[model samples]
Target: MPTTDTTTTDALAQVVAQRFTDTPLRVGTRTSPMALWQAGHVADLLAKRVPGLRTELVGIETTADNWPGDLAELGGKGLFTKEIDRGLMAGQVDVAVHCMKDVPGDVPLPPGTAFGAYLTRDDVHDVALFPAASPIRRLEDLPQGAKVATSSVRRRAQLHQYRPDLRIERIRGNVNSRLRKLDEGTDGFEAMILARAGLGRIGEAGQRPYQLLPMEHQGKKVAVLPAVGSGVIGLQARTADAPVMALLDELSDPDTAACVTAERVMLHMLLGHCNSPIAGHCVRTPDGREFHLRGMVFNRDGSRFVHAAAWHKDPATAGSLVAADLLRQGARDLINATKN
Candidate 1:
C-alpha cells in the first residue's frame, strides 16, 4: 500500500484555508429579511470554518419579491432565484444562497451553475399565526368559514383538505410584510400559515406566539406533509469555481444533503410545477443507517389526493420508490390537473 501523507495533506489544507481569507467571497441573495439572515448565516459559518475569511452579501431584488400578483401567474417559483443565479453565472458573485424550496424541481439548474452545499436542515413544520387580538390559538380553533392567508398552493390545498369550510386567501411578501398585513387586519385574514424555519431565521419564531399546525391529519394521524426542501438552505456556485466549491464542501452536512437530494429527486420525477399541490419530506433514521421519504399530491381544491412512503439504504432509491408508489396511486392525474 502507498504510504499515507498526513503532514502534506495538513499543509495543503492550511494553504487552501489561508487563500480564502485573502479575498472576500461575494454571496448573492434576495433583499428580504429572511433571505438576508440566511445569507448572513452562511457567511458566519464560513467565517467560523476558515478564521479571518470575509464574505460580502450582494442583495438583489427578485421579481417574486416585488410582484404583487400571484406567483403562479408570474411564472412560478423560479422568479425568486433567477436573478441571483444570473449574477452568479455572470461572475458578478462567487456564490448564491437559496431557500431550497424555492428552487424549481420541474427544470434543471441553469447551465454552469450547481449547488455546492446544503446546510444542516431546520424545522420543517408549518405554523399558524393569528393577529395579536385574535383568540385563535390553533388550526382547529378557527371558526367555520374563517379566512386564512398563505402564498403557497401546497399550503392552500392542505388547508382546504383540513378544513373544507375555511376560506383560503392569497397573501404574498416577505415575512415581516406578511406579519404586518396580518396584524393590520389586511384583507380580513384571520390567520396565516408560514414555515417555522423561515420564522426562526428571521428571529420571529421565538418572539411570536404561534401554534404549530399538526403535520399529521387530525384524528387519523396521516401526515399533511411539507413542501419539498422546505427547511434547507442550498449554496450555489459556478461549476468551474473550484476554490469556492472546495470551501463549500466543508460546509455541507452529508445527512442533510442526502435527505434533501431524495426529496428533490422525487419532485423532479413527478414533474411537479408551481401550481402543483405537491409535498415531500425525507429523513434519516435515528440509527443513521437508512432513509425514509414520504410524498403527497393533491388536486387544486384538495378534494382528491394520494400519498406514498418508502425506505431505502440509498437516498435516490428511496425517493424513486416513493415517486413510483405515488404515481401508482394516481399522483400524475392530480399533478396534471393543477397545470390546467
Candidate 2:
C-alpha cells in the first residue's frame, strides 16, 4: 500500500531540471524606451513563469526608428519589425518582441518565423497630449484650424473625419521625442495624438496632462476605434524552436490572442498597410461567448469612409463577416484611393 514509484518521480524531476539550462534566452527588440520596456516585460513574464529561466535583451535599431521622412516612402510599418525578424531567422536572438500594430498585415511574416504568443491586450484608446501650459483640456476645446501632430495615417484620417477643420501634421520619433516636440511648441504643435498604452508603459499617462479622445461624437465618452493589433505585444520565434515555442506558449493570453487574431484577419482581408487609413478592433462580449468586431476603411483625407461591425462565436468568422460587409460598402475602393 505504501509502495512509491521512485523511478518515475526521479525521471520527472530530471526532465523539469533540464528544461531550462544556464544558457540565457536572448530577446531581440528595438532600442527605444518603449520598445525596451516591452522587451523587459516579456522577459519578466518568462522569468516569473519559470523560476530558473534567464533572459538577455539584444537591442537592435530598426530602419523605422531612424527614418525621419514619411514611412510610406520607405516601405511601410514592416520597417519597424523586419530587423528584429532577421535576428530571429539568423539565430542571433531566440525571441523577438514586437508591437503587434507595427507588424504589417498586407504581407506574410518572414519565412521560417512564427508568433508563439500574444500578450494580454492593453488600453486601446487614443489620447491627446497638450503642452503643459496650454489651456485646452479636451479635444473639443481646441480652436478650429489648430495644429495637431501625429505619425499615424489612421489617426490622421480619423481626426479629419471627426474635425475636418483641424490641421494634422506629421511628427516622428520615439514617445519621449515627440512629447518634447509638443512641449516645446515645435512646428506649432498645439496637441499630439498618442496611444494610451504607450504613454502608460513609459510612465507618462497620468503624470502628464492628456485627454482620451472620443471614438465618435459621443459626448464625454472616452473611446477610440484603435488600429488593428494596437495594444498587443507579440512574441515571435523561429518555427523550429520547439523549446522556446513551448515556453512562449505558456505566456500566451487566450482572450488577447482571440481578439488580436480577429483584428488581424480583418486587416489582412482589407489588405491594410502602414499607409492605409484602416482601423479595426475586436473584443469578447461580457459573457465571453461571442467576439464582436468593428472595422473601418477611410480615404486619406477621411472625406469618404466605410464602417462595419459584426459578432460571431468564432473570432475569424466574425472578422470575415465584418470585412465582407465593409467591402460590400466600397471599402476596397477607399483603400485603393488611399494608396493612390
Candidate 3:
C-alpha cells in the first residue's frame, strides 16, 4: 500500500481556510459554581475547536437551586435545562451545556431544538464522602440508624437495599453545601454520596479519603450506578444553527457519546425520572467493539429488585435489549407499583 501525508495535510489546510474562520458563539449554563466551571471549560474547548470562535457564558438559573420544595413536588424533568432552552428560544445563546444526568427523558424541546453531542467522559462512578475525622470507613461502617444524606432516589434505593435500618434523608443544595452539612454532622448525616466526576471537576477530588462507587456488601459485589450520563456534558442547540452545530460536532467524542446514548435508551424506555428508583451502568469491551449494559430496577423502598445484563454491538441497542430482559424479570411490575 502506498501512503501520502500531503493529501491529508492539504485537506486540513482547506478546512482551516474555509469553515474555521472567525465566528462568535454563546453558551448557556446554570449559575452554580460547578456549572460555571463547565461553561468555562466548554468555552476553552470551543476556542480550540474553531479558529477565532469567540464565546460568552450566559448564566441561567434552573431548578437545581430550588430549595424548600422537592423537585418531585415541583416538576422533575427539565428543571435544570428549561431556562437554558428558553435562552436558545429567544436567541440569547447559541447552545447550552447541560449535565446529561439531569436532563429528562420525555420533555419535548422547542421545534428547532435538538441534542447535539457529548464531550469526553470522566469517571462515571459515584463516591461516598465523609469528613476526615469521621470513623466511617465503608458504607457498612455507618452506625445502625445513622443518617445518609442525598436527594437522589436512585441512591436512596440502593442505600436502602444495602442498609434498611439506616435513615435516608432528603438533603438538597449544591455539592459544596451538602458536603458542608455532612462534615458538620448536622441533619444527622454521618455521610453523603456524590459523583466522583463532579468532585474531580470542581477541584475537590482526593481532598479527603472518599469512597468510590460500584460498592460491595455481604461478600457480594453490588452494582451502584451514577445517574445516566453522569460524567458526560450534553450540548443542546437549535439544529437550525449550522455554524454552531458544526463547531460542536467537532467537540463530540465518539466513544463517550455512544455509551451515553445507550444509557439514555434505558432511562427513556423505563420512563424513569430523578424520582424513579432505577439505575444503569454500561462498559465497553476491552477491544472497544462491544458494550454491555447492566440494568437494575428497584421498588421505591428497595423491597423488591430485578437485575439483568446483555451485550450489543451497537451501544444504542444495548440498553434496550437489557431493559427488555429486565422487564421480563419483573421490572415493569416494580415500576408500576411505585407509580401507584
Tens digit per residue, CA lDDT, model 2, 35-64: 999999998987765566678999999999
Worst 10 residues of 1 by lDDT: 1-10
Q: Which is better, 1 or 3, measured by TM-score?
A: 1
Q: How many steric overlaps are in each model, in order?
A: 0, 0, 0
* Model 3 bad stretches (over 4 Å): 1-23, 215-223
Q: What's the candidate order when arranged by decreasing lDDT?
A: 1, 2, 3
The per-residue C-alpha lDDT of model 3 at residue 158 equals 86
lDDT of each: 0.86, 0.86, 0.77
- Sorted by TM-score (best first), the order is 1, 2, 3
Output the number of the lDDT-best candidate. 1
Candidate 3 weakest ten by summed lDDT: 1-10
Candidate 3 to truth, TM = 0.90
Instruction: Give a tens-digit lDDT track for model 1, residues 39-104.
Output: 999988877655666788999999999999988888899999999988998988888999999999
Q: Residue-wise lDDT of candidate 3 within 1-340, one digit each (tens)? A: 1122655534543463354356447789998888889999998987765445567899988765764567877777578787888999888888899888888865666789877779888888878787667877677777888877778888888877778897888887888777877777657678788888889878899677887767334354334766777788988888887666655666788778888888888878887755677777777889887997887888887878888787889987998897788888988788777654
Off by over 4 Å in 1: 1-23, 220-223
